[model samples]
Structures are given as structure tokens and as C-alpha cells.
Target: MFWSRKEKEHSSKKGEDFSEVIERIKSGDKKLRERFINDYRPFILGCVSKHMNRFIDIENCEEFSIGLMAFDEAISSYNSIKGGHFLSFAELVINRRLINHRKKEIKNSKVIPFSYFGGENEQIIENSISEKSIYLHYDRFEMREEIMIYNEKLEMFGITMNDLVKKSPKHKDSKELMVGIAKIIADNDNLYNKLISKKTLPMSDLIAFVTVNPKTVEKNRKYIIAVCLALKSDLEIIKGFIRKF
Candidate 1:
């Protein structure tokens, strides 16, 4: 499967000389289609395997089938004069197809079970736990409780639960902001717990204490920070009880 420098150069020259094959394909040549598949099988398989590993849960034969189909599609539609290496162009098409395939599977199908072919078992366990049913059940319950407690605390500062829940962060910035908020709460346990135990505060009053204004709270900076602090306090309390044993 290894190519020497001379062989690599020869392959490149042959690929470049595929201009006629490309034109015939555009004109709908059936045999040239088979030739294209024969020539690019190895390269396409390697590229698909490297990129599509993240999405597919199939064996080597299944992956190869997908890769070959992607290669055939690439050859039929590719134009060499677009200014890059043909293999590179083909790789892009294959990768995109693989990613789209994964997205469709995630959205439409159930979790794939792990079958042992002699590798690490941990990944299988982890993937199993991330199943949609388990995740949705836990996430919905936890998020609802968190929202309720957060509203209760915001009441002391005069903020309504409805306004706070409506102030969710956009997708990209949520995780980092939540982590920072967690650290802040960890550093201030008593205050964090006190806030969580309260009932009603004006939205404006709560925002003023945690942020420069109500708008900042709406932007999620204040809410994330408050959540992080409360989570940290809870963690510490749990750890303290564990230590008593």
C-alpha cells in the first residue's frame, strides 16, 4: 500500500492526464466511470475512513461502500480546471457527504449499539449513555428545576422567572459563560445558596446586583454567573457530606 517517490510522480502524471476521461464522463461515458472508480479506490477509501470515522458506526466493508459511492459521485461532477489537486477536490466532496450522512443519522435514527471487534469498551459505554432518550429525560428535568430555583432567587432582587428563562444565551457562547459562572458560585457558597432559597425580587433590582443593568442579565452574563456559583456550592456541600463518611 506504500508508494515510492517515482510511483507517486507517475500516479500524479496519470491523474493529470485524466482530462479525456473527465470530458468523456461529462459526455456520459459508462466505461470511463468504471475506470475512475478503479483508479481512485485506495485514495477515496483512506480519505473517507479518516473523516467519516466520527459519524459512522459500521464495519470496514460498509465504510468502503460509502466511500466508493462518494468517489463515484465526485468523479461524475468534478472539474479539474477549478485550480486545485483533483484528489483534494474529491476529498472535500467525500468529507461533506460523510458529515451530511452523520447528521441525517443523528436526526432520524436511534443510537447505534456497540459491537465488540476488540477495542476500548469505554467509548461504547459513553456513547450509550449519550442516547437521546436518556439525555432528554435528564436534561429536561434538571433544566426545569434550575429555572425554578433561579426564579425564586431572582425574586429577592425583584426579577420574574419568566423574564429570566426567556434570556437564554445563543448556542455558541453558552458553554464558556456557564463554566465561568460555575467558578464564581464555587467561590461564594453562602451567598449562592441564599439567592437560590429566596422567592421574589423585581427584575430590575436583581439585575442591578449581579450586572450593570437589566440588559446584561438578558444577555446571559448575569444568569450564567449566578448558575455557576450555585452549582459550585451544591458540589462543595456534596463533597463535605462524602468526607464525613
Candidate 2:
């Protein structure tokens, strides 16, 4: 069920008008800024997580960061002269930023399709069903070993293979952009070293060197960092997985 009548009343705090609260917040009230953030913590976080359709660890979560920033943006950017409720404006800001963040991450991600390593069928010389089964088993074994090693490498970044599965960008255009960014990182020695030595992305340097923005770099930090690690190393097996993508 949606929030009950009582819940709405509690959220309103003595039936104070929502727009009035925004006006007070906008009037250079430092205490209200902190108080409003504190009061609406659940609302902001809940909006983001609900939009993302996942359990958000708002504590240090990227979505949380983006959402709170969007809220701040809404406060500064809102205009009653144009005429709209504060929450409506805030929701629009939150939704747009969340979508922008996702799109940025998708573009920034350098995807290596793990499916390349697996063999489907080849119509081998062996015609019997049993023989085909044997070949399939061997191929399956090879794919499993490759996946295991890939997962192990991902562990260094605190991401599991499962996480990649959930995080894969569906759009081909996004995937292409990610691959292009990965190529830039793979070719540049300084970029590669920062990814390896610092364990963080050189987003500013990359933006200066490549055609990407801070939002893109920040969104896809984990995926880009992981792919750089794979590409820079002697992980030929993992590199092989990247060939088709």
C-alpha cells in the first residue's frame, strides 16, 4: 500500500505547506538545510532506490550521492513563479539525474562479453549423439575454468562475476562507447598505471585526453577500472573474452 493518511501527516509535520518549507529552506537558513536533509533522509534515499529497483546502501552509495546532489539542485533551481510543487520538481530532478547517471555508467563501462568463451555447436566430424555430448562437456569445462579465473580477478575490486551480469548495459551503442573508452585506457601508459597503482580512475586526465565527462567516469568507475586491470595485465584468457565485445 501507499503511505497511509497518518504517515502523510507525520511527513508534513503539523500540516506545514510543502512549498512554504522549500521557501524557508531557500531563504539562507543553514540550520534548515541540515534539518531538511536529516528529516527527508528516508524520502530521498527511498526515491533513488525505488527508481533503481534495488536495495540502496545510501551510506556511501553512488545513487545516494547523486540523489542528495539532485535535491540540492532542486532547492537552488526551483521557481514558484513558474508554478509547481516542490516535491514534484524534486522528483523530476531525482529522476533525470538517476537516468543520467545510469546512462553515464553504461557509456563508461568497457564490456567484455564472457559468452565468447563458450562454444555452442560446430557440427563436428563425430556424428553420434554421445560423441557430440562429449565435445559439449569438454567445451563447457573450458568455459567454466575461464569464468572462475575471471571471477577471481573481479574479487580484487570487490565485485563478483554475478555483479557484472546484473550490471551489463543492454544498449549496443552504450556498449560501443564503453569499448571505445576502454581502448583509450588500454593504449595510454599513464592511464593504465593510475588504474593499477592508484586503484582509481584518472577521470580528469581521461576527459582531457578522451571525449568523456566526469559523470561518465564516476558512474562506470568500477567496470572501467576492472577492465583496465584485465587489459593491462597478462590475462590473455580474460582478454580473449573481450575480443567479441
Candidate 3:
């Protein structure tokens, strides 16, 4: 949504390989390199904004600077023959750098601001956990980062965050039922593998393990897959949230 139609058309022109463009940049084309980065500035900002799940104030945001650096790093490190789109690799790098930045911020935020109370014999803020506000901030950051990763995984299965909101079961009992179904898939190696590889519910196979109506599974397909993916992933924060049900 950030990129313009003209730029979109330009990028989509047949036979244009960005790897070759990177090669040109590496071959000492300073102007081309600058032009490329300029052209992709919107993309860099878009990535940062999407990661933060809010519109970025580019001039004031550290994440935008980090995103640009990550894009440059991706340009330097990408291996086209390794088999993935250049932008996909760039997004991965951007997310990694942003998450790392969040972690460093969390660490820095733990440092006590008051130095007057400290002496060799006096008690300082010995544990950062004393700062409840900072600890909660770090927790929120972790959850946001986890959700970003989950969003990417959902895209792979043709599910969006919006889809989750719309398709989630309304009743508590139905929600519990869905989680139960997801756990069945997550706990079974063969069923989980089938869901991952096929990018869809193995409904027929899933039905064999549950007594739920086939129509219920069909209606809540996206939510079921999402829950199953969360259980399969190392997303402790999301798993914790899911445990409420």
C-alpha cells in the first residue's frame, strides 16, 4: 500500500532480476545504488510501520533508520540462488534487526535512573524487576514481536490478521472446542506435517481424531490453523494468551 502504482509497474516488468541490480551496485555504480535505495525508501518505511503495527513517524523513529540499514545488509548478503524473493529476504532481515533493537532497548530500560541512592554499602535497585513499568513494556514488546512473526507465518497459509478477527468463534465453548482441535493437530506429528506442507487443514484426517461437526471445522478453518501454528511455534507469549481459553 505504501508503494506507488508507477513503481509497482516498473518493478513488475518482465525479465528484471534484482540480483543483477545488486550486482550493478556492487560494480561501483554509486548513482544506481543511491537511486535504488531512494526508490525503496517507501518499502523500508512500510516494513518498519508494519512491524510496529502503526504508522511510523519516519523522521523521529529509530526503527526506520534500522530498517534502512537492514535493507542495505540484505542487499549485501542476499543469495539469489538460495531460492527466495529479494524482498522476502529483506523483510526477514528487517524484522530480525528491529526485534534485536527492541531487545537492546528493553535491556537499557532496565537500568535504574537514580544513582543518588547507591553506595558501596547501600542497596541499589539490585534487580531490574523492581521497575514494574519497564518490565511490562518489555513484555508488550515481546508480544508484539511474537505477533509479527505469527503474522508472517499466517500469510504463508493465506490467512491475515483481519481474517482471524472475523473467523474466530464467538462463544467461549466454541473457542475451547477450536483450541482442542488445534491441540490434536499440534500434538500429532503426521497431522501437523500435513497441515504445514499443504498449507491447509487436513480436515478429513483431522475429523478422524475429533468428534466435532465437519461444518464447524470448515467454518473456523483459519482460526484452527492459526491456533495449531501457535502451538507448533516457539511463541511463548502467544501461547500464554491462548491458555486463557
Best by TM-score: 3
**Candidate 3: where is the Cα deviation over 4 Å?**
1-130
Q: Cα lDDT of all candidates, in order?
A: 0.51, 0.62, 0.77
lDDT of 2 at 71: 86
Q: Model 2: number of clashes?
A: 0
Evaluation by lDDT, superior candidate among 1 and 3: 3
lDDT of 1 at 206: 46
Q: Give lDDT tens digits, candidate 1, residues 162-223.
A: 55466555554564544444444445545344434442123433443444355544466455
Clashing pairs in 2: none
lDDT of 2 by residue, 1-245 (tens): 24446545755675344665567778887776676766677879887876655677776688888999898888877754333345655655776676566545444553322222223332333322343444454345445544544555566567776666666556777666776677788788787667655557777678877666678767666666566655654334577776667
Question: What would the per-residue lDDT of candidate 3 be over residues 1-245, giving only the tens digit for each residue?
Answer: 43446646767786445877788777887777677778889989988887776678888988899999999888887764333357766776787788677666657665533321234423445443445564565467666766766786788789999999999999999999999999999899889888887889998898889999999899999999999888876567789878898
TM-score of 3: 0.52
lDDT score for residue 153 of model 1: 38
- Cα lDDT of candidate 2 equals 0.62
- Candidate order (TM-score): 3, 2, 1
Off by over 4 Å in 2: 1-131, 233-241
Worst 10 residues of 3 by lDDT: 113-122
Task: Single out the weakest 10-residue window by summed lDDT for candidate 1.
Answer: 233-242
